[model samples]
Target: MEDILRQAVGVLRSMWRFRWWGLALTWVVGAAAAVVIYTMPDRYESTARVYVDTQSVLRPLMSGLAVQPNLDQQIAILSRTLITRPNVEKLINMADLNLEVTSGPQREQLVGELMSGLRIGGTGRDNLFTLAYRDGDPKRAQRVVQALMSLFVESGLVSKRQDTDTARRFIEEQIRNYEEKLTAAENRLKDFRLRNMALLDAGGRDYVGQLAAVSAQLEQARLELREAINSRDATQRQLQGEDPVLLPQMPNAAGVSIPEIDGRIDAMRKTLDALLQRYTESHPDVIGTRRVIEDLEAQKLKEIEMRREAGPGQFGSLNANPVYQQLKLVLSETEARIASLQARVGSHEARLAELRASAELLPKIDAELAQLNRDYDVHKRNYETLVQRRESANISVEMGATSGIAEFRVIDPPSLPLKPAAPNRALLMLAASVAAIGAGAALTFLISQLRPSFADGRSLREVTGLPVLGTVSLLGDPRREASERRGRYAFAGGVAGYAGAVAVVTAALKMLQG
Candidate 1:
């Protein structure tokens, strides 16, 4: 610590050796800096404060029914990115700052100046923003601030409209896509029904249920058919009571089955009669039906031959007895009904076989049907939601037009600055003086290092790395002492001159600031 203090004292002594040089340098630098500071143009700052109110009375009321925008976030982003190059150019135009710039470089320089001078500061939480611009002309600063405010307002409105338009277009496109999906789904369902029409029952049950129901129906139909056949046989048995008459004419094929050849023959004749009304006897259906009747007649004749071989008796007719005729009619009707029921049962059996064969295919069809239904429902639901949202968007936009979504209030109008806000002359002058003193000290220190002087024997010994054995004392001279005193007076006058110069420059700065 003692060595450090001694080193500092040595440096001060070195600086003191060139004290006049330092004082002269200080005066020159300080004067020059003061002049520059005084001549520097003043920058006036203009500012405008805008407060964004994101909270609206309608927001809570229309929460779910309307599409709400994030006003705070949008305003914050706008405030930050508003100072873009395009916006700067716009600002220049609005403020008439580009009228004088004829060259490309000048325009670029002006754009850069505008961007740099424009300052935006705000907090998203508060939703408050301050737009500021600095310029040499106070009126021009105010004009720039005004132009920025106008841009902010216009951008906000334009952005809101653009967002609304984009959302509407998206929703409309989705609705169109969903409509196509609905059409496709309907067509698919229609095609499925058409393809499976043969297998499907009137009841809208799955294929397994249809199979069970059809089996049950077939059993019931067969029971009825059997009952009808028995009734017809009983009627035939009653014909045996008709004086042993028409029994010889009928075929005893079995007790349960009476020969339905007569009833079939009657129905075919009726059909033939109907066909004759629509077409000539030469028609293929008439020829085929007539051929069937001839074959049946041959079978009847063969049955009679068998009956005659059993017993040699003449075939008798019971058409004379009215009771026998009535019984015969009943038997014929019953046979007809039994034949129709048999056809129904056969159809049912075939369907049941088809269902059993398609057991694996049934499940696949069912699953496919379920998937299609689910997809159709999903698309429908999404389409409905998008439609409702579109309505809500329209409502929101209308409400915004009526009540506004957000409010941009000018809390403070653009301020017209009257006084300069920059170029602190007093501070700059002080710094310049301090720097000049530092420069002089540096110059003297360098000279002292080059031509080193040892004030004491100890320093010389330290430099020499040797022990000092003795010291020499010089006698004082009156002329030399007087010369030393005069030199001290000259140094004091130089100091006074430095102080006076500093005081004069400071006075001038104060007057100019005023």
Candidate 2:
């Protein structure tokens, strides 16, 4: 410990020898720091607060009527993307920042600077944004912020309108497609109906329905014709058995049964039963069957009325041969009825044959027609819907143009800064003073190591590895003592004055910054 203390004292003595040089170097470093601090440019920050009003009364009022965009999310995205490179470039143009830029690298550097320096704050849901920028020039800082604000609002408007326009264009194009499809379907259906006019009727009668009607009529007619032939054959047999000379007396007034009428009624009843098995009574075929039965009954009532009006003499004359006349009359009546039934049967048979031939082709046509009709209806519906959507889009565009979708209000406009906002020179000056002191101490320590000296005989002996018989001391001179004392006072005063100068500069800088 004693050796270490002596060695440290020896190093201090060496440092004291070069103290003036170290002090001068320290003062140079301090002055350089002060000069740099003084020359640093001041940066002024411009700030703007924007409140985005995403809510609109028109939004709810036109809910289903118009397309509503998520304005809050859109504005949030705009705020975030506002500091992008392209936008920063546009901001430069808007602020005329490119006027001084002479080269592409400078412009690129400016863009990067704007990107890094631009600041935006606040959350999407809050809809409140703060844009800030700092520049050496206050006017330029304020201009940048103002241009950014304009760009933000302009981007929102342009992007929104573009979105709406794209949607409307797509809708319009689809509408045109559906319109063409609808028209084509209509023309196909019309052509099909025109080509097969006989197969289909205005009452929606197709091949199967026509075939059914024809088959039923043919069956009924055959039945009626068979009855008429039987009646006519029976009457002819009876007339062959009876002699022409043996005139029978007039028969009693009791009326005979109209078997032919009963047979026709039975045939109609059978037809009704067949139709009922396939369709409800509400079906057109079923209704027609009931109406035919009523008509047959009405014909029977008219026959009865004619018989009563003509009297019993109408059946046969008492003076003439009653049985011969009655038999002949029955034959004639059966022949006429058979002729009418045969004609009806022939007409129905021809119709049934024609319908059956068309059945092969009719079914395909019917199915295709149904499909076409369905497709047409679907296309028509979609076309109508698209037309309505187009109208809605137009309304939205008009509304956007007139009323504005999102309202932007600047709560705090960008303003020119009155004072510098950056550099923090006071703190830098204080740091420079501390650094100067440390540099001076380091310089002295370095010099002490380079020019080593021994303070006593123990250190000298240790360095030489030899014995020191004795130590020499300078004569005790008061003049030398006083001169060393004065030198010590001067070194102390130099250090104190340097420290005081640093303190004064730091204080002055702090006042200037404020």
Q: Which candidate is the best by TM-score?
A: 1
Model 1, 100-140: lDDT tens digits are 79999999998888888789899668988999988899999
lDDT of each: 0.78, 0.81
lDDT of 2 at 293: 69
Clashing pairs in 2: none
CA deviation > 4 Å runs, candidate 1 = 1-10, 197-353, 453-504
- Candidate 1 worst ten-residue window by lDDT: 250-259
Candidate 2 residue spans exceeding 4 A from truth: 1-39, 84-86, 102-105, 200-363, 425-511
Q: To one decimal, what is the Cα RMSD in angstroms of model 2 from the true structure?
A: 11.3
lDDT of model number 2: 0.81
lDDT of 2 by residue, 27-144 (tens): 9999999999999999999999988887777888998988777888888887777778878888899999999899999999999899999998976677998989999999999999
